[model samples]
Target: MDTDRAAAVDPIDVEVGFLTPALRSDLLERWNEPQRRYHNETHLRAVLRAVDALEADGEAFDATEVRLAAWLHAAVFDPTESENNERSAVFCERVLDPSAPVEEVARLVRLMGGHRVEVGDLNGAVLSDADLAVLGSDPETYDTYAADVRHEFAHVPGERFVAGRIVALEGLLERKSVYLTRAGRDMWEKQAHANLNRELGLLRAGAAG
Candidate 1:
């Protein structure tokens, strides 16, 4: 299980030396909300690690903005709310300086909604791929992840839950690729397709039942 789990981890860790202690603390605190269970510190850390791995290949990208986006991506999502990603971006802008380049941050934040953003730009591609790496993880890790996400939306009716999840899964399927990095795509694309297919199949079965 450990070997299988480790295989899914991105092989690098970004140095966040530029992040102030206060800023780091604030980001951590904000992500502690119950609705953010699956997208919390652990998720941020994993994405950052993946970004670092991608950077090791000498990719030209803004590390700071990417890290910031990873930290703030899900900070505004209330699974029940339609504009959660936009609201989250607004919150991120407020937390940062008014003079900061809000456009990039806002774009990155909004990109977290679905896989379409995977093809946006180099940074967008990296961050989006990292955010979704879990989908291609081994069965044990993937199963645990699915449970975590479902638990976050446990308040919704069973029918609503199934419908919502199917929509999300299909969005991923409609994407050109789930992982933008060549290495990531080669390693995980098949797994991600399988995972999405299984989830969609389950949703169909649930709807039929």
Candidate 2:
């Protein structure tokens, strides 16, 4: 499904027995925080849809855990906070049902900090790929995503932000493969590389100038 269409749907629509109405409202409110330019409910929906898309493409994973992770991945987004992932993970562990794979869900949420997943980690693979799926979006969408990220960090000085952004982009480029799953590779690998390279070049050039 397209990001726009997927993002338009409320994340509460995704069926999960563990997610009570009160909890869902709290999570949705976290995502809708005014400071969030990109890590909002829309991004959460896109990630959930991406998980479904990957599964539909035959990627094996634990759906309930992955979707839970997806919902809580950016649940504590604060552009100024370096520990959002850890905070998010802690929050996930605190609020999830006792029977839920709370540890697994928290692990997946923490993985978002770097998108690094070890081989054979099916749940991690799915969640990581879904979170990074935006990197492979079509040019216009990717551009918008990039702009939104900058806006989220608008308080940073241009030089510092560009320097930091360059580091982040290069880290992704240096990954053996930006996407972890077979389906993720087939769907977005090449486009993700292209998008990263294009953006990296522009940032480097701007820095040099």
Top candidate, metric lDDT: 2
Q: 24-129 in candidate 1: lDDT tens per residue?
A: 6777777776677677667777777666656655455787788777877877667777787788888877777656556787788888875455343887887877
Model 1 misplaced stretches (Cα beyond 4 Å) = 1-18, 57-59, 98-101, 118-120
TM-score of each: 0.82, 0.93
Q: Determine the C-alpha RMSD for candidate 2 after optimal superposition of all C-alphas.
A: 2.5
Best prediction by TM-score: 2
Predicted structure 2: clash tally = 0
Worst ten-residue run, lDDT, model 1? 10-19
The deviation in Å at residue 206 for candidate 2 is: 0.8
